[model samples]
Target: MTDHVDVLIVGAGLSGIGAAYRLQTMCKGKTYTILESRSASGGTWDLFRYPGIRSDSDMYTLSYPFKPWTHGNAIADGEDIRRYIHETAHENKIDQHIRFGHRVTRASWSSEEALWTIEATNDERPVVITASFLFLCSGYYNYDAGFTPEFPGLEDFQGEVVHPQFWTDDVDYDDKEVVVIGSGATAITLIPSMADRTKHLTMLQRSPSYIISLPQDDPIASFLRKVLPLGLAHRLTRRKNAALAIGFYVFAQRFPRLASRLLIGAARKRLPDDLDPRHLTPDYNPWDQRLCIVPNSDLFRTIRHGKASIVTDHVAQFTKTGIDLESGDHLPADLVITATGLQVVAFGQIEMDVDGEKVDPHEKYVYKGMMFSGLPNFAWCVGYTNASWTLRADLTMQYVCRLINHMDANGYAFGMPDPTGAEGESAPLLNLQSGYIKRVAGMLPQQGSNSPWTIRQNWFLDSRDSRRADLDEAMVWTVRKPVAVAG
Candidate 1:
């Protein structure tokens, strides 16, 4: 059976839910349905079950603009975030429109019909759906598995090995010696979270990543909530946080050396005297990659209490008991955890075609950081790497709504960003130097150096420009023709 709607939204997580709410309220009477690959909502929050699974970004900015986050802790746990998304969907009655366990595999756009044909699977059975517009809210990373490098002699190790992505309940860590590999956010979070439970925990990394400490609760937000109305306080707090984040990013980019020094100095203060400061220092400057946030210096506190340690060395091989380092040192471990990284993918690895021609993302340019050039009625929701993901995602959602309303007001059948003479010197869509991003650099879309094609990561500029954007400047709009009746 085939289903059709005015709009087809992919994924039921944070961005997907937000997209639905915006569409229903702003574009009233528009028919839409959400197709989620997973059986549940809360995309990232529901999938990741590792210990210390909390958002690095503050909840105030990460939350939807329409909804006020009343949680006491600015840095929230995974379960709390999951509940928040669920509550939003329930309150807005968005849950009724979601089709769970439907994994979208292919989407084909037809300019003649001004529509899209979507192909998905529900439990190995074929399910087809059609829509006027397709919105991909699926995240960038591969959900099936995380990135883990091949370590030598892994089969020889008698102990159980685990990855944070697929952490299960049966895996025991209580009073067991554990060694977590990698130095990204996941590794840092695991080290502190598992320190107390494990007999001894050690973080083994080949290189260092910049880590910063932040308070769990925000005093300003608490005070504002007490004094002002909920809606006004939330707006003010959101703006204040956004401005502060942008200012720090600009300062770091302009003065990298000074920023690096300040970050290293702060880490040193929290770290134990015996621990080497080199372990906390990265070769690259701050903000080069996403900074790891440690709430209330939990990682440092755990290390200082002799519950955990850090090892900066290359792994030579794995033995029956533990791993041998290349620096002529062997560390004992009973359990091994690989918190390497995530496997980045474009548009949730969905195969996209326009008029039967396969769309190569690398050859295409991103229009306004959301839509693709020459692709009509399609938008992908991608967030900021330097700041909270919701900041930019909200802007994209609002802009899409505006485009839909504009098309309806006119007699336009569909609109697409014209690629002719618009492609200049292009760069990678994402501006991050992280390992995951670099791995798939040649697969994602390109961003030009000019407006509407360039992805400026500034929230202040994007928020203002989105509202006053000239929809017809680089877009090709098709006018709807009257259908003739046969005599």
Candidate 2:
């Protein structure tokens, strides 16, 4: 099947919906389509249904700025987030443009045609859609399944095992001994919430993660929400959080040792002294990997009250009885939750080729973390590594809208960040220490060491560059030129 649209958006998540909403509002006369792999909206929020799941950060920073989140808590739960995404889609009428059950398997660019050919499987039927532009809101995490550490005898265990991603309404852990594997944010988030409902909860981590504790609720933000209107409370929190976020980022970058001490102190307070440190403390910088967000950090309160316990031991294998640790210790459990991190996919593992020459994104320079050099009319959203991801996401959505308006007003089919010698050549995108950056290795391109896109992970720099930066500084935006009509 062949379909034509002005723009094709993939994913239907926060990024995809944000992109689609802007496109629909801006290109009112043009046709647009959104192809989501899942039948529902709310990409990650809908996908993750594990108990004790909620937003790691405050809702004020996590929510879309255009709309106010009226949820009672500063850090929202899955249902609220899912409802928020659904509500946003409804308010913007984005759901009407969305085509559910269409999974985009491949998106290839055509230089001759100056368009992207998106191949998707709709209800298992092959369909191809062509559009002047392709926007990826598919997110970085995989939806197929969450990763589970290889257990030697996982099948031997008679008890039911669970990965948070596949959590269902049927799996009941109430008043039963349960073990949650992994020390990351998911495990941290799960421990406190499940402990309340379970007879016993044990957090088993082969390795430890930096656990920063906060109260289960944000008292200040919560108080503001109770007193002020949701809109005013949101604005107040946004400004306060934005400033705090920027300040912390500056301190972390400028004074690494000092920042680490401050963060480590916080983590130490939450974790026990008897627990082994070798596996828990990360070898890298704090923000280099993600920092766990604990609202009121209910995890600490749960542990302190003796309702939950944390163990730092290398898991050996799964047995019929329970999980065996590297120390030859056995921990018995009726249910086990594998909350072990997530698999990161760069550009959702999509391949882009300009003409016959393959555009290896890993080898291409990233412009503004959205556009790739040598490729035109393509934009992707990669949010902040720290703080509420939506903070950067909101700004990015607005920026894309600006770019769309700039292109339409200027009369350009679509302009790409041409990193050729004509503009500014020899940019690289590799960081010496990033796991994702290292994974790409030789295939990854590097930006100038000083380029905002290179070292500018902070919200302030991004805010200035994306919002107020001179457009000329970045090699994005289109210079619209009339298309030559067919003879």
Query: How do the residues 8-68 of candidate 2 rate in per-residue lDDT, one tens digit apiece?
Result: 8888987788777766665577678989989999999989888767887777777877677
Q: Any runs in candidate 2 off by more than 4 Å, and if so which? A: 26-28, 215-233, 267-284, 419-448, 452-455, 470-487
Tell me the tens digit of each residue's lDDT in model 1 across 131-232: 999999998999999988889999999998998989987889999999999888899888888887899999999889988888899899999999999999
- C-alpha displacement of 423 in model 2, angstroms? 12
Cα lDDT for residue 128, candidate 2: 90
Candidate 2's TM-score reads: 0.88
RMSD, each candidate, Å? Answer: 1.1, 3.5
lDDT of each: 0.91, 0.74
Q: In model 2, what lDDT does residue 422 have?
A: 27
